[model samples]
Target: MSKLEILALSGSHRHGSFNTALLDNAKRLAPKGVEIKIYEGLDKLPFYSEELDGDSIHPEAKRLREAIASADGILLAVPEYNFSMTALLKNALDWSSRPAGRHVFVGKPTAIIGASSSILGSIRAQLHTREVLHALQADVVSRPEVLVTQAATKFEDGALKDETARLFLVQVLDNLVAKINTSELIKTASQEKAS
Candidate 1:
């Protein structure tokens, strides 16, 4: 079997973001057959505008779209912002959703996990993100979510060193991988039946 191509998108833009650290830790603990890549250019995407979208879309926007288009699955690490998703992530999604008929996020498999300093651990943000992904026509993994609260205490020096958090992240990754593999198998079977 080939390695699963997984795109890890961090919703926080801060250099020392806890959510980013969690994603970084996930990269280290990813299963053997999963190839994880962290996307760090969400801040570069401009606000979505139909007039600016054409054959000549912004280079950054184009790059982000292409990354999503090429990925087999996506893992989003979101941080709560006033009980909602961040503008940076929302902006990236907006750009990717443009050209209506040619959306990059359509039919993609996605999973969301979040970490925050508050006790709620960005749970609301994760819920909102799941809804947004659904609207984008994504096959979102709905189980085994990771919501790390008091994130500063769980991770140290830009790494998630806590035993419990690490275990939860592993479970989340496993669930995501299972979902991806199952979807792939179903797709292949459908193609065979069609043939």
Candidate 2:
């Protein structure tokens, strides 16, 4: 009955990025009892380096890890760049999955949605992002995929305006919450079995 918190990461840092706008819409469309917190400072993270990760982790990386650990779920607003995910997003993932076994992403529920001005709607980026999350052992939502193609036409005043896109965004948020609840239940069951 407590509120579910989802950490949202925007893969783009451009002013008025479509992916960032998608995240804003996601925040607005999230269901009741769910809170979508959009994370900033992705651009401030230093490039991942083992030397930098040792002993004293970068403050930004530590902040990213802490946010991931505290959230019940993650939502990624990915953007396509040359048929791949942006380096900024890849960098965040690298920082989040660190120290070989102390990463924050293992078994965490996540959902991915993207918007692009192109007709493909960042599908390639989303696919790559999903693959990375899987590698990190994150539980990713696979249904009601939200790919807002030709996204330039889908927004007004920096908010999602397309009715169909809005509807699908709602479904994505709902599915994310469901995945989180299911994950919690599974963890409880495993604990009970062990005890």
Candidate 3:
């Protein structure tokens, strides 16, 4: 089988963000057969505006869509802000889910992990992220979520320092790859039936 590629997107734009560090750790801990690419272009996307929702969209939005389309799965590293996902992440998702029903995330298998200084460790933000993905009709990997609490101590300089956090990230990657494979199988079976 060809290697699976998973796009990694972090909601946090802060330099040396904990969530970004979690994604970096996940890339390091992922099994050899999978490839994870962290996307850093969320800052370039404009606010979702209906006026700009024309047939010709922003170049950054197009880039995000193409990246999602090429990947076998998606990994979202979210930061909690006011008990929900950061606006940066939400805006990225909004841009990708545009034009109504023809978005790149439709039916895509996605995994979410987060980090925060709070004891809950961005769990609330993860919940809200899941809701948004579900609304987009994306297949989300619900288990093996990595929630790194006390981010100040768990990560340093955009890297995860905790061994347990690394382990959870590996688990999340494994589950995401499995979900991608299962989705491919279903798609193949459906194609066969249709033919």
Best by TM-score: 2
- Tens digit per residue, CA lDDT, model 3, 94-188: 98897679889999999999999899999999999999998899999988878999899887667788888788888888898889989999999
Order of quality (lDDT): 2, 3, 1
**Which candidate has the highest lDDT of all?**
2
lDDT assessment of candidate 2: 0.92
Query: In candidate 3, which residue pairs get closer than 3 Å at backbone N, Cα or C atoms, i.e. clash?
Result: none
Which lDDT tens digits does candidate 2 get at residues 1-195? 789999999999999998999998889888999999999989999989988896888999999999999999999999999998999999999999986666899999999999987999999999999999988999999988799999889889998888888999999999999999999999999999999
For candidate 1, the C-alpha RMSD (Å) to the true structure equals 1.3
What is each predicted model's overall lDDT from 0 to 1?
Answer: 0.87, 0.92, 0.89
Candidate 1 C-alpha lDDT tens digits along 128-159: 99888878888888877788998888877888
Query: Residue 124's C-alpha lDDT in candidate 3?
Result: 97
- Candidate 3, 54: how far from true, in Å? 2.7
Name the better of 2 and 3 by TM-score.
2
Compute the lDDT of residue 86 as modeled in candidate 2.
95
TM-score of each: 0.94, 0.97, 0.96
Q: List runs of model 3 lying over 4 Å from the truth.
A: none
